[model samples]
Target: MAGRRTERIDEWRERVDELCYDGERVEHRLDLECATVVVTTQRVLAFVPTTAGPAFRHVDRPNVGTVTLETSQRLAVLCAGIIAAFAGVATLEMATSITVSSAVPSVDLEGIAPLPGSNLLVGFVETVLAAIETGLLLLQWSVLLAGVAALVAAIGLITYYIRSRTRLLVVRVSGDDDLVVPVSGVDLEDELVVDLEAAIRPAPESTPALEAEDGRRTSSRNWTEIDHEESG
Candidate 1:
């Protein structure tokens, strides 16, 4: 598992490397289950690749603001949705089954001649229930497939939660969405966080260099005055 994680990080680092402009160097990167946050000298970039193509969001280092750990309900909400979907699928299947099974007659209708017409009625009811069950089964098929997908998503998110070391970093930026990176397995406590906070922090004011030559100017007016006094 650790080896696979390394490979994944390497792949993202390559991708982040490709997107970097000439002379821009990657300093720190936080790899998440669904996205990657990369900090460079010039800017901070968040990448989330989709089926369509690669997606990107970034902020210049100057614009990167205060970074704080915000409590996240994203995992909780997703888990709830997955649980609800499974419950719905089970409930639907249960209801359909109950309806289907109840229509069968306990006594044999074929043996009684006086209730010949009654047999047809029972057969009609059974046929209707069967059709309903078929339709419900198709609906359940779709629901079941959706439930499985949710389950997979839940598992992935759970992995992310554990690997993040129970951390949620929210990178506040100016004029852009905050970079909410769900981190993956990496002990970047001293290195990565400092790099990001440095971006957020205002740069220290620089004092002007005193490199210019400082001297009293020998003015043309002073020369003219001296010449006039001499001529006088």
Candidate 2:
């Protein structure tokens, strides 16, 4: 049983690695539940699990251009406020609807034909009551719809927070595509960036001496041409 469990765990890890990098051996790994970053010999891979599905991106060592970090506190607070306001309004409207529905008395206009002024008064009261009920019903529905919209917006904001609240590691690839990975904390961010930079920084070029030689040759040729023109 122990052997089987160990084998299963290994298989699961292998599956996850394959899903991200097609069997690349992971040299460094940071797991954040919703997001993960895996560094291999050849590339850095970021995986994000979203509502639609799991999204993954791989940045070749040579193609990594830059890394950045950011936060989203203001947007999160704004979304929370909107959600609370809509929820409060919805509750208030619902309570008002219930009270009005129960308190208002139903009137019957079927039987007695009364005095002329009495008839006008009765019709006016009926119209007024009906308008109030209709307005309350519409108001309740409108508030409910508003509450739903606010709830959706709040959920979206929360999702964004979950994906971005932590120090976000934003990797810019050579072709202008960016791969964002959320790290758990600032320490992790610093450590990961250091590791990535060390791994991906290109080796220093040895072409400076060649470039200087080429410049010297070009200058000598120009001087030779000028001397020949003067002689002619």
* Residue range 114-206, candidate 1, lDDT tens digits: 675876777876687678777766765666666566656656666665554445567888886777765444533656666668754545555
lDDT of 2 at 165: 55
Output the lDDT of residue 88, model 1: 57
lDDT of 2 by residue, 1-232 (tens): 6465445544544465564446656677766644666667678776664313335567787787776665535675666856765775676566555755755568776554565577887889898898888887787767677766666766676676566555666777888567775555534644667766555565455588878999999999999999999999
Which structure among the candidates has the greatest lDDT?
A: 2
**lDDT of each candidate versus the true structure:** 0.64, 0.66
Q: Model 1, residue 57: what's the lDDT?
A: 71
Model 1 lDDT at residue 121: 78
| Deviating ranges (above 4 Å) for candidate 1 | 1-12, 31-35, 48-55, 74-167, 184-192, 199-232
Cα deviation at 222, candidate 2, in Å, is 38
What TM-score quantifies how close candidate 1 is to the native fold? 0.37
Candidate 2 regions off by >4 Å? Answer: 1-27, 50-54, 73-166, 185-189, 203-232
Clashes of each: 0, 0
